[model samples]
Target chain A: MVSNTNELSHEAFLYLIRQSGIDLDTGHDKELFDYVKSVLSSLDPLRSIDVGSTEPPMMFIPAQEDV
Target chain B: MTDVNLCYASVRALSELVSKKQVSPVEIIEAHLQRISETEPVLNSFITLLADEAQEAARRAEAMINRGNHLGPLHGIPVGLKDLFNTGGVKTTSGSRIFDNYVPIEDCTVASKFRAAGAILIGKLNMHQFAYGPTGENPDYGHMHNPWDPEKIAGGSSGGSGSAAASGQCTITMGSDTGGSVRIPSSFCGIVGLKPTYGLVSRNGLTPLSWCLDHPGPMVRTVEDAALTMNVISGFDPKDVASARVNIPDYTENLNKSIQGLRVGIVKEFFDAPLDAEVESIVRKAISHIESMGAEIHEVSMSMFEQSQAISGTILMCEAAAYHRELLKDHAEELYAPVRLRLESGLLITAADYLKAQQARALFNTSVNALYQTVDVLVGPSQPITAPTLLAQSVEINGTRVGTTAAVTQYSRPYNITGTPAITVPCGFSASGMPVGLQIAGKAFDESTVLQVAHAYESTTDWHLKHPDIAS
Candidate 1:
């Protein structure tokens, strides 16, 4: 049986790397994880958004003023 | 003898004879079945032999030919499918104990395509469990041994397809690559394996390893054979969202296209690293030959090439876990040891981390956009070393031990991340006498140049003509 879908640990994540066949002597596992995590942590690609009652999803039939 | 000549002959040649009535499909299928019965005992490359089905199909093909009904270009040719690829009524174990009893209700996209083209499937080839590892060391199936040396690993997850194709059990075999599954085995087995552009082949009835990374492609003893198989398997699928909507070009039409004026890039960084002395020599020789043939070989550096691999690891593991989560819950006891461990570990990764990895993938893709601008294609040593020993954890190189997956797939996986097409064909062998591979990669969706270069190399060398010494 399975449980606990949340709160995964860093240690656990690293363990998965070894099991995946990427656990090379070059410490590529650590390098790969750290690099990917750092990139993901730094990229702030999107911010919060809100939808209004008057508006539909953008890019509809040419809007006169908002075009 | 296995008629060693016909084992590696092009499918076009075989089809020509079949059409001319010089040879019937019955005779061709009998020869292959006989060869498989003799060699497969030593190689242990097959999971099941569909001899009865194959002969019946061949008889039907003969009937059609007698009535002047030509099914298609691949009419009357025999082929093999990797076990993970679903074939209705045949056991589709994926080389794991988890699905040992499972059979599919529908044939996979490729299998149906082969049938439509009149290609008869001989059997299901063994593979790494759930297509996870590189060594093709399946605990349940007891690993497919390399045909060149019984003690060595055949290389995987396409190991059996490679071994069977190289040994003439089937002239063409289909195997999936999550990371170098097709190309690595092809390199180790000394055959041609082309992992088409990620979405070029339909994924519909094949079991998923990593949805984004798994690519099903053909493995055959020659470049033209691989191209012929590719022509049949490549096209858009309404069922596969990732399937390329682009046109599937006639790969054979350009097989002899002069690469004379083509600009080929040789990664300068790749040469600096110590490789098998013999492998390094063969690759350098291939580069020179291609250069002397009027193609310009420019030594280029893409530091980003080295980092694209990290993105591959992240993306593959996360998606793999997502796919295997339910199986891990219900049948953890049923899964094979290593594959079970692999999937269980994936279940523990958080979704945020998985999403983060996908974000990093976008960045890595951006980083490699500059490489295609400078070079028409990139060429390098397929595997840093030749095939290693079966059941062996690692191999010693230059007084340092490298893990099997690292040494075997280092050059092949980076391209998988970028979704660029790559092909590996035998170039030469090592001093200890194992096959070596020259890997050629082209800009995304440009399999033509990749095939052309491989064909050109095959035309110039006799390495592709050699077969594993499986006769005993």
Candidate 2:
């Protein structure tokens, strides 16, 4: 099940990881899931900000002269 | 001078000795090698020691100087590169066992530049595995031990660079910062680390952690040594697609210039975060010290600064995951546990969230740049606390407990988000004797002013003059 909201629910996250073809060790599954969940949770505040049509920041600009 | 003194001498001091033929390159290399041997047992700073290559390079440098063919300040100086940099025919593990046998056919641009400048390659320093974690906890190799206190972390992902420079195992070292890898270690190890403006230094051959956020920089014992290193490394590289074509200036030319009437801003949000009592006191005192030097200090607010981790983390994870997609799929189990989990987390970040984070980053950059319009630089504590003990999973700040990684990278992520030049200089020491760093950040690509401000503060204080007593 794909996540409808910005935050991924535990079931949705597990589904996505399962789809990713990454096998989580049974013994460490709980530990691994919690770690990823914490990382996602930290970004929760970003969803509330109003970006106002601003373009995403440029990562790099291509040089005219080829290397 | 004794071997101990020779090992700790700054590049500027040793450059003069080399130029005047008072000290041969061979003697300098020997001193550093001897120091490395003594400190390696405790520091665990280097994964690959290049004593033979360093001596050979020193001999070549001596012969060239004998023929009156000097290469300049960096000539005959010793430098250690983080293992991420690809060196021809030499292993570049990047702090992981997976790449233990990987060797490159050609030298990375940075390594080649240093070689051309006649800097001896001392060794390849260790780091956090794949430059993922903030603490120097690498299970594949021994954890990087602090020169000040072996029980404490040296700070990562540039942990080994920090330990080596502070312990006098190398005169100068290179560190790459995605968030605060360079400055964090510089703070914990009591040294100078400078992350030049994004695109100021090329990332041509560095192992990528995050393509957009990764920045190669200098971690050294003094500000002038950083400037000297920058002179050789900073320039437009046609090969690097992200390399800026802006005119490069002599980074050392503005040193010793008066910082009178210079405006320095203190971000209110920086202090609003969780902070240690001693760290807050030391950073504020450093600000007052700058004011005493005729620099105007102002309290500024950038509300978006608090959201920096979200913005930087999102982009970093997506890019890092995209780059390492195959590696994770094919060899996930080979990675360290924490690093493996972090990389897997990146796979879960939706494209929408990644883009949303970048949009927020655009706003964050706008807010920070506006502050520079009012103030020449932003000043704050480099890390909220000093180096944490390796045995502890988290540290207590005030009455609250916070994870070590979160606390260390809090202040560092903002500068990386802005892609501006930021530097960390030792301001003072905590009650327990760990060093505190005062960060000075300037407008994008304006490293000259950043260096000027840091150099001014460094020259007026005795903080940078102190070294770890690891040898004793």
Candidate 3:
């Protein structure tokens, strides 16, 4: 659950960005970090909703499966 | 008819004229070309206008019809495709400078369908870069201007399609709706935008916004025109994995049918959300009109509607980021800034967050399905407000200032998540003279009913007949 509505810590933000594998320009990290935090914050309310055992609805059937 | 009147004529009217030999295809194409030339300065609707090619095609259509080999309704009808649709031998920019030179060798499925229907391709309409934002502000190409007032925005990602159809630059334009892209512009521009059920229309040739959410639909001046376009485009395509194998109906066959016993639901959350008082009043009156037409109106509660934005945003961000990961890494600076930032933000979404959002989506769909059992369709305002001024950061609705993106998309995103058929028809105009939209959503693959209700409402009201003065 995305319980935290607050922005991510600066270090955690950097770590995530590092883990993303996309090279970052250090100069714009502040703005980029804030943007990412806002996006996460937007999804925070979603975490509180109990989806229970519902599947992700991601389905993929190979071409060979056709009747 | 005068050039302007001819330009503003509906596809049905033009089709009759073409089929009856009262008007040549060349005349129809020329009339629209003339209209486009007059309005292009103000609308900036087309990224690539295929003037010479359209004229040539019109001539060929004229020859075929004269020889008694007439194609049905869409034959010789002028249409514009949002730049994301792949047109063989023509540039498909997706409204970004990064693809300013990209041309596909083969037509996308929809484009080929339009061609098979004998429709004339006037040009590629402009859009929000890569179909990213709701407002048609593209730094790569110029921002799309509203037909009602040149100063306000034409709603985006399908902004160009919206403007083109509204301004009479094209009889029918296609827009891809991920989260309100088609309906948003349709409402803002005073046209009909129909987003068919998730798999009803194929996305084989369209550039992906969010594969799971992307829907290619028709943005036209009338409800019947949208139905006509659907008749041509809706079906299974082996190339599109998401395409449904369901039996496709002739959408126009029952378009004029009665909705006497139709059960229309009004989601309480639609009004309870941050909505403009005028927009609310207009939509309420629209529902009452539907009731007056022998339809039963019920108030249904779908509290999960509130979670639509969060759910759709997460999935779209992840999908779009994954699709453009290489572009973000290499040509990052070339993308429109807002789109760039949005793509980067997606890279930050955790796998848990993505999966959680999807899980929430499954539940959300279940809740929506349960509500559908209670009613045949849900009715709401297509947007909270009329078109905002170009690049306005926020719009105040009911004394609350909300971010523009959130406000524009608030009511339109729920159907995208459900992947159901939804449409926006011109209900009324705001006091400021901008158009207001009445959105109607139906059960999955129920576009016929949705179109029926919208056509009934549209025929009862003169809203669709009022063209922007700019077109004149």
Candidate 4:
């Protein structure tokens, strides 16, 4: 497991892609890896925030009758 | 009235003409169909045109009006859908090759509501593939061109809705906003686009891009038309879980209301960020114009505004990826390059990362809601720049180069993250003849105030009436 998100290596990134049930053997593999790296970098700062006990963001709720 | 004049008239005007028997619904539909035939070649706004059905519906509307049965404000008006909305027995492609042949068996909630109100469904407009990107460039469906300048882009994934409405191809259109999809196009195309509070409008039959962030709303030629459209399409639908159970108010009731004593907050961070010189000047002039109208203006700040992009980007990727996981595995090759890349990138996000972004979103919403307590509405630039050329991937803003996708949606996406009602109206034009937008947003479920402020500003300026000279 990679502890530091910003420091994720290309090898570890490819390993995670395969683990997610995606085969990265196509011609677009290099491009896909670069995009994954960009996304992970963008998400690095979010990992450090303290969310506390707030509920996860959910846009929809069951009607009152169902509740 | 000439066909060109009828094509550009407001829904309010057209409905009155239909009710008074001065203009038959058949004539209105015929005029629009003729306009579409003339403009479609240059705009590339529509994926499919329903000429035969539109004429048939117009005749029915005419016969009903002839019998003294007036449906209401939207009666006999021709409107367009964003192509992602399911229309019974009509092909809904969603601007992707993956679903090119998929036909829905029933109309979505919004579509059914329009039909119920007597609005004619003219056609389905083009969009970014699966509503993934903001540029409105689709490799599968031909790219939608900006009505203002054919060489520039019409902001997307609701790109076609913007171009069609601006060019008078339709009276009003519907578009979905995940991260500024609706507002971006409206800003770029010089029209009115409103994204109502999260649960204000039901998303039952629309194709899902990001479950939590997706908001289906109105894009029209005037703020009043947007308000009128909202009156017909908004309310609680038991089928849509996100549908708000609160009472739906008349969106147009306060259009003529005075904003004399209203408090308007000009967000300091929005102007402080890097922006095009022309856009910044026009937005400032709009603010000064509103101040001159007797409304009180004050500078306010929200620090969390800076984190909105990352938070919105994360949630959008994860949710969209979850929805398209199976499709990605089976049909990855058929997807557009940028869209497929975005979907696959979601695979790299861990569950922890997704939850962290949601947590950040909750904080951002709290901060924004608290700020509303200090002011009635917030005003800023809808987009930081005008439309860019079709071939350019990035633009120079304030002497620094930035990606087009990031700059186009910078100001509008924050509202989606907070689930507030925000509207974009044409404020002024740039030196180069492109349009600039002024965004006014109010507290959650308070679309009335947003529309009221926008309409007030629009009444003072002739920006909305200016149409692109497409023939040139």
Computed on C-alphas against the true complex, the DockQ of each candidate is 0.06, 0.65, 0.68, 0.61
Would you list the rank order by DockQ, best first? 3, 2, 4, 1
Score residue B466 of candidate 1 by CA lDDT. Answer: 85
Interface RMSD of 3: 1.9
Candidate 4 — which pairs collide? Answer: none
* Model 4 misplacement above 4 A: A2-6, A59-67, B1-4
- Give the CAPRI rating of model 2: medium
Clash list (residue pairs), candidate 2: none
Candidate 3 per-residue lDDT over residues B1-472, each given as its tens digit: 4343678888888988889898898999898998899999999999999999999999999999999999999999998999999999999999988899999999999999999999999999999999999999888779999999989999988999999999999999999999999999999999999999999899998999899999999999999999889999899999998999999888987778898989999999988899999988999999999999999999999889888999999999999999999898888878887898899889888888889999999999989999988799999899999999999999998889999999999888999999999999999998999999999999999888899999989999899999898843
Over 4 Å off in model 3, which ranges? A1-7, A62-67, B1-4
DockQ of 4: 0.61
Clashes (N, CA, C under 3 Å) per candidate: 0, 0, 0, 0
lDDT of each: 0.79, 0.90, 0.91, 0.89
Cα interface RMSD of each candidate:
11.1, 1.7, 1.9, 1.9
lDDT of 1 by residue, B1-472 (tens): 1232555567987877777777788888998998898888888788878999999999999899878887765888889999999999888998887787898998988899898899998899999988988988777877898888878888999889988998888988999998899999899998999988888999999999998888999998888888888889889987786788998889988899898889889988677654777778888998898888888888888665554455566567668877887776677566665565556555544565455555555555555556777778899999888898887768776667866665776787777777789999899988877999999998888999899998988998899888777855
- Per residue, candidate 4 scores C-alpha lDDT tens digits across B260-334 of 979999999998877888899999999999888889998999777767778899899999999989988888888
TM-score of 3: 0.97
Which of 3 and 4 is the better model by DockQ? 3
What TM-score do all the candidates reach, one by one? 0.87, 0.97, 0.97, 0.97
- Model 3: docking quality category: medium
